[model samples]
Target: MDLSVTGDPVLAQDETEVHAGIYLQKGTLTLTRKGKDFVAYHALVMFASANATPWAAQRVKFTATGPDSKAVEVTVDLLNDSWDGPRAGIAEAIWKVVALAATAAGDIGITYAPPGRT
Candidate 1:
């Protein structure tokens, strides 16, 4: 699997009011299973709201190449909008994309383990 985070989140500042501000982020992920490869495009947008302090939405599309390839795409609003931290939020999003890609790959018998685990 290859994952590349092309766009790092650049938060806009609100000098007058304290808020998380707004930003746009992007990434690409590729996973291979059973001689097939799936490529996913990820996009995220953090929006500024007067009523709410901070909020964000994310979308990912997985495109596959194989005899039995299937495409999976999803969009979620208010995903990890809180102050839990960027690492946690991004991890959650990445896992979601991975799961979606795996599902789209069909019965290729693909399984995943943590790094350094066999």
Candidate 2:
């Protein structure tokens, strides 16, 4: 469950979770799972201006495209230099953004034809 920039991080089978970040150096990161496929919805970046420090933000939305199509979103905020403690709102914001994006992608495809039908 721990993701490192140096070592290869793999997902656990029994676990349906994912983490996002950039690799400091060139390395191969493996995504392991018991019987599920991993899909990344989008990537986010937060950087500072020239006069300021650099900050990074990454968000990955995973949807199980197998027998069960369950959707879950994960967001990782990288603080430049100084490490900021984790915040609950961060995760919430991530999910909100993911949901909005998904909704905007297309219609729900639920049409009400009623008894008469069209």
| TM-scores of the models, in the order given | 0.26, 0.25
lDDT (10s digit) by residue, model 1, range 28-55? 4554555655554443322222343332
Clashing pairs in 2: none
Reference-based TM-score, model 2: 0.25
Backbone clash tally (model 2): 0
Report lDDT (Cα) of residue 26, candidate 2: 15
Each model's C-alpha lDDT? 0.36, 0.32
Off by over 4 Å in 2: 1-37, 49-51, 54-67, 84-118
List model 2 lDDT by residue over 1-118, tens digit each. 8875677865333322223322212112112256544344343322222222222222343322232444444334533235442233344434344334333421322121111123
Q: What is the Å distance of residue 94 in model 2 from its true position?
A: 16
